[model samples]
Target: MKEIFEYRALLIELVKRDIKKKYRRSILGILWSMLNPFFTMLIIAMVFSSFFKFAIKNFPVYLLTGQLIFNFYSEATNTAMGSILENASLIKKVYVPKHIFPIARVLSSGVNFILSLPGLVLVILITKAPVKFPIVFSFVPVLYVLFFCFGVGLLLASITVYFRDMFHLYGVLLTAISYLTPLFYPKEIVPEKYMFLIKLNPMVYFVDLFRDMVYYGKMPTLDEHLNCIFIIIISLFVGVVVFNMNKKKFILHI
Candidate 1:
C-alpha cells in the first residue's frame, strides 16, 4: 500500500494517459463514452420493449441504469486483467509497483463510466422517466461496484499472467453473467424454483441497488447492504490473497 502511495503521481499520469489514448484521434472523443451507452440502450430498449416486450416501466432508464453499471464492471475487469501484459515492457525496464497497472486501467474505465452519466440524464428527460430518489444516493451502489470490480481486476491480473487462457475464459464468464443478471427482464419473470439463482448472483444486488436509486426511487434495504458487504468482502479477500501470491511470479510469465 505504501509503495502504491509513494508512486501516486505515476498512477495519476497513467490514468490520464489511458483516458486520452482511448479517444486520441476520434472526432467525438470523450463524448463517445456518453453516446456509446446511450445508443446501446436505444437498441436494447427497442428490441426488448418492442419485440420481446418486457413490462418494465421507463424501459430506457431501466435498461441504461443496469447497462451502464455492468458496462463499467465488464470493461474495468477486462482491461485490468490484461494491464500487466499490456505493460510488459515497462515492468521489465522499471521498478514501479505492479499494482498500479491494473488500478490505472480500472480508473480509466471509471472515467468513461462517469462521462456516460449525462447520457443517462438525457434519456431520463427525453423519456420523461420519473425521478424517485435523490440521484446522489445512486453513487452508494456505484462505490460498492467499483471496489468489487477492482478486486476482481486484481485477481484476474494475477491469474492471467500465468494462464493466458484465463482471458478467453473470463470473456465467456462475463457473457454468462450478463444473462444471469436481470438487466433487461423483471425479477418476477424468473420461476420460483430458480429464485435461488437470483440470490446467488452477485451482480443482482449491485444492479438492484442502482436501479432502486435511479429507476425505482427507493432506499436500499438492509438486505441489499448485507448482500453487497458479503460480496465485496469475499471478492477482495480472494483477489488480494491470490494477487499477492502470484504478483511475484508475474515478470517471468509476462
Candidate 2:
C-alpha cells in the first residue's frame, strides 16, 4: 500500500495515458464510452426482449445493470492482460514495479466504468424503476468488483508475459463467460440442473449483488455478500502469489 501511495503520480499518469490513447483519434471521444453500452443495451432490449418475451419488468434496466458490471470486468482484465507487453519499452528501460502497469490499466477502465453510470441512471429513470436512497450504497459492490478485476488482471498480465497465447485464449473465454452469466435473462428461467453452474461463477455473484441494490432496490442476501467476499479474497491471494512468482522472469519473455 505504501509503495503504491509513493508511486501514485506514475499510476495517475499511466491511467491518463490509457484513457487518452483510447480516444485520441475519435471525434466523439469519451462520449463513446457511455454510448457504447447504451446502444448495446438498446439493441439487446429491442431484439431479445421481443423475441424471448422476458417476463421481467423494465428489462432494459436489468440488461444495462448487468452489462455495466460485466463490461467493466471484461475491459479492465483484457487491457491489463496486455499491460506488460504493451509497455515493453518501459519494462526494459525502467525499474518501476511491474505490477503497477496492470493496476493502471484496470484503474483506467474503472474510470470509464464510473463515467458510464449516468447512462444506467438515465435508463432507470426512463423505465421508472423504483429508486431508493439506499441505491447510493451500490458503490460497495462496485468496489468489490473493482478489487476482483484488479486481482484477476494482475494474474493475467503476469501470465501473458510467458504465454502469449493467453491473449487469444482469454478472448474466447470471455465470450463463454458472458454467456454463462445471466445477463439477458433471469435466474428463475435457468433450468434447475444447471443452476449450480451459475452459482459457481464468481461474476454472477458480483452482478447479482449489483442488481439487488440498483435494479431490484433491495439489499443483497448474506450468502450473496459472503460469496463475493470469498471470491475477492481468493482472487487477490492467488493473483499476488502468481505475479510475484513470475514477475522476475517477465523481462526474458517480454
- Provide the overall lDDT of each model, using Cα atoms, as 2-decimal numbers: 0.90, 0.91
Stretches off by above 4 angstroms in model 1 are: 51-54
Q: After superposition, how far is residue 223 of candidate 1 from its true place, in Å?
A: 2.3
Cα lDDT of model 1 by residue, 102-190, tens digit: 98998899889999999999999999988874567898888898889878999999989888999999999999889889888888888
Steric collisions counted per model: 0, 0
lDDT of 2 at 135: 82
Candidate 2 off by > 4 Å: 51-54
Candidate 1 structure, TM-score to reference: 0.96
> Which pairs clash (backbone N, Cα, C closer than 3 Å) in model 2?
none
**Judged by lDDT against the true structure, how good is candidate 2?**
0.91
Give the TM-score of each candidate. Answer: 0.96, 0.97
lDDT of 2 by residue, 8-83 (tens): 9999999999999999999999988889999999999998887556477788988999999999999999999999
